[model samples]
Target: MQTAKRLFFSLDRQTECVADYIEPDRYSFLEQLPENERYIPRGAGLSYVAASFGSKSISLGLSKFNRILAFEPSGEEPTIVVEAGISLHKLHLFLCPQGLRVPVEPGHPQISIGGCIAFNVFGKNQFREGFFESCVEEIELFHPQKGLLTCSRNENTTLFELTIGGMGLTGVIVKAKLRLKRIPSPWLNVQKIPFTDLHHMFQVMKNESQTADSLHSFNDFTSFGKGLGRGFVYAAAFSEEDTAPELLMTFKSLERKPTRRFALFNRLTIPAFNAAYRTLNTRLKPYERMPFYRFNYPIAEMSFYFDWYGRKGFVERQMLVPEAKLDPYIEKFEALLRKYRPQIVFGSCKFFSGKQCHLRFAGTGIVISMEVMPNAANQGFHDALDELNVHMGAIDNIAKDSRVTKDLIASEYPEYGKFRDLLAEYDPHRQLASALSDKLCL
Candidate 1:
């Protein structure tokens, strides 16, 4: 076991802190930490919020435990057992050779499997495939008092439900048995369709969501009047033809790029970037073929985009607005943007189809993600966004933005109180916790 003071950064680069960090090389060393002390398990530590560390809590690093324990390929649906600390990138590489993989995955390649379960992450085709919970068959969790427990839909059901999106408050995730599906191909035929407005884009998105293998839209928010919400929807499906193995880029773990001393995205540069990006995409062929992994995880090659936000970092807020309420929500959203003119550097939309559950981001609606520089002048804009989202009955993603208040989350998610009560019932002492849990009182 190694103990030291380590500085950890949130994925957005907004928060950084020095925490007592512990890395145990073996299972026996995991017992060294005082059973009663509070600590949060750390995987890749890529959460946008301060989820893995706190000022007073110990951060238990699980990187050393990353490994594929077993694989069963004989069944109609094969399953793989992997340690919690394995990165999705590494897992994909292992599954690729066997023509098997998980269906739902968040964009980043560096995110850990344990983190995916803890957050109940969604993917490009979330509307069709469902959340990360749909991919998990069983979980092995460890709590100081409860010892080790096996949880699934049929066993320790409540803990299974809670631990899926429980934000690591339930206990330490040791490993999991994840259900897998066969990969149709190692490549995707991506079709890019440009739209003149948000409505037009969403219309195409809605239609494509029904048949496309994966779908998402990008919008240009730099201009308002005629140009507002103009962007492209990139819909992709697995290709029927296979490319030579040597032609594809090798799958590897991604590294976080160092941020610049000063922010590159601001009022002056954001508009230029948006225009150039739209132009570049428009000039490309309408349909293109590429490695499936590249489309699923563009961030693997674009990590420097986050680094451009610099030391002060940026704020990313993602929210889900019901399709029925989308018109008014967009009207309200545009009005807020026109009124405040927050320099929205990037905007994207995706379709989600799932019932609301325990603070998880899953829902039946259109999910929108906006990234903005966290400048002093933009504080009011962020606050107005909070109000607008609540007024429009949109559920703001709690994991994406650390600034979301407990009141805001409570007001939006009907099950917020139930989650709190359940957590209290399970861990009255709250032995497993983090800065995020502390803030939300979870």
Candidate 2:
């Protein structure tokens, strides 16, 4: 047990203070904090690098607070009130049966609703459904000072908007009432399309989602740009009619291991994975009736999947580029990846046009994500990445440097400062401010 009532650091990914605890237990812990004491809320510990690290404050771990509080029937927009600590994966189990779902889900479901709401998470579906925030009708907050505050789209509208993508700086999200979608039996009618490179591929995707379901695309560094690293695409839509439940599968015998070790932090093995994946996937064009979870989050064992990068301590870099600049940016991005050749284990890219979030990262554009070993002597490549990030055509730099400059935030998010101001009204004493809140410059 960490034996001090003082600063107890917790972290995830790689950092000094990786927190542990789910939402249920975390709720209990927060209610017991030293009165008026400063604390940061954390869930799943899946912030990629160090989103939850904090000093001079209690690290409120909400891992155990997870629970499907209440879920209603699907006749009139099935809805559920969930503990903030509940993982999105578990949430799916509750809704999948009714063919209902939260409109927006990130690539992986291990992320907690507390985190997702704070980040105002969006997905390929956003071209249609918007973001995870859109699925949320209301949220309940627990403040160190205030006992409990109920906020909803209709009641406390400002609180609701600020809490979305607010990064837990506003208050501890104890519970949330999220709207669920009616589906055709928890199956995704999926399609896989290949592009010579980024150009034709991205174009087709944007057009498809304009009138279709969710979509996500990725560039195989081993297949496109002077290499075999072309692009692989996955587009999915819910079925119109109910389908039979998928036979429950098991990973224990499936053998979906990533790899034992890295030969070097270069691009050799990655390209091979890309080639093999593309070959097998090419045969899967217009695949149909897949389990929704499989289609949404490829890594079904999300808890275990997150740990895969840890065997070697990895980091992910994500960038949101506006639609107009996506083509030119892809040209440069592909060249940069080829030249650097960092051992990118896996990655996914997708688009979104969500409700404007103060300091929120997504906005009617493309978000590219890549996982890599942080200390693989890849500084030269990392430097190039930094340069590209600095000059990416239309991306709001607020997403990249939210920690450094508040001005950049006002520039990109436009309303971020207002969000912070509202946050101040809710938490004037700065009791809920977190390392992420500080970094997001909110």
Candidate 3:
């Protein structure tokens, strides 16, 4: 391990930080850090905001501690115990041959399992499977002052809940026991349905959630006037048959290309891209069988997609609106998009259900996610978004960037104070801190 001065940025490339970095290969090495030294545990840094940013502490990188500690794929209840640093892609690769896989499919395959738990990530299948914490059976954390501890649903229940969506402020997660699912084949029976407006799209999504194992809508944020909110709703379920002629056993190798730093994402380019995507998808048959990897991790295929955001980068604002109030919220959202015409690089809609963890970003509602390119004249856009959140009683996803304040969290989440108390009790000295924790007063 070595200390180096460098800048760290999230996927949106919005939040940047300069700090000391260290990579500890073993749990003992992490535990040996100076007792008084402030540090923040980091996984794949998949959180698209300041959640993983450490401005005033050592950024402890856990990438080197990747290892699968235990595996039992032949039993009725298959389970895998893996080091926190292992990527979702690597984990899936190890289990695919055994006809087993993790249930929660977060968008990015590069994200670490530890980060997924910390963020309590929700995916297209959230409406059916709930958040990432739903699959977690147990977690092992190493605290600066409290030493190592193991928590599960049956024992240390409170700690298990706290660490699932704690954002790594509680401690460094070293290992996790995850429940796995068995599949007959490594392919998905995919279907793409077209919708003309946001209302129809949401209606179909709500209905499809009951039948589709995984579903998400690709929104046309660049469209306006007659074409506003026109997009496709993609849904999928595992194939029962063993035949998988189109199954890609491994992800295609991404070619290294020079970054297009000066590229501009505007109304013209975005609309054109959307039209092309829609046209190409519309010609395809209604149902097709594709590899599970392609269906679950589509973003990984476009390795250089972030280059379109340019140097200034972008910010994603994701809000969870209850199904009862979705209509009004979508009305306001459409108006905001029309008025500001922000350069939205990507956008999607997904349904969620069940009770959410203390700090997790899920509920029985619909989650609308949009990546907007920041501009000087978009203050009104921010204001409208904040107003929409309040009007719809929505909760901001901590994993995404937004204008969230301490008061908002207190008002929206009634258990915020209790969560704070737990944090204080677990780490009394407040040894684990990050820019996000300090900013939100956690």
Highest lDDT among the candidates is held by which one? 1
State candidate 1's TM-score. Answer: 0.96
Model 3, 1-442: lDDT tens digits are 5778767776666667787888888777876788988888888876777666578888888888799999877778899999998988899788887788898978778889988999888777888788899899999999888888999999888889999889888889999999999887888888888998889988889778778888988887786687787888898887887545434545432322234486567767877887777777756566777788778888676766766777776778888898889888888888888998777767788888878557778788888888777776776887788777876788887778745677777767767888899988877888888878887788
For each candidate, give its TM-score against the true structure: 0.96, 0.83, 0.94
What C-alpha RMSD separates each model from the true structure?
1.7, 4.5, 2.4
Q: Model 2, which residues run further than 4 Å from truth?
A: 1-12, 18-32, 227-229, 249-265, 284-288, 302-312, 338-342, 375-377, 380-421, 439-442
lDDT (10s digit) by residue, model 2, range 1-442: 2414332222123334323322235455556656756667777655643445465456677777788888886567778899898887788777776667787887567778988887777766777888777788889988777767899878878878777777777778889898887776667777787776667677767778765687877666554335434666777777767487855532211112233553343455556766677778776543666777777776655445544444344655566777767777877777777777676766667766744556677666777766666664666776676666557643443322222334444545556667778877766787775565665555
Error of 3 at 209 (Å): 1.9
Ranking by TM-score: 1, 3, 2
Candidate 1, residue 24: Cα displacement in angstroms equals 1.6
- Model 2's alpha-carbon lDDT is 0.65
Q: Flag the better candidate by lDDT, 2 or 3.
A: 3
lDDT of 1 by residue, 194-296 (tens): 9998778889998998779899988998897876888999999887677434134334443334455788887889999998888777776677887877888
What TM-score does candidate 2 reach? Answer: 0.83
Clashes of 1: 0
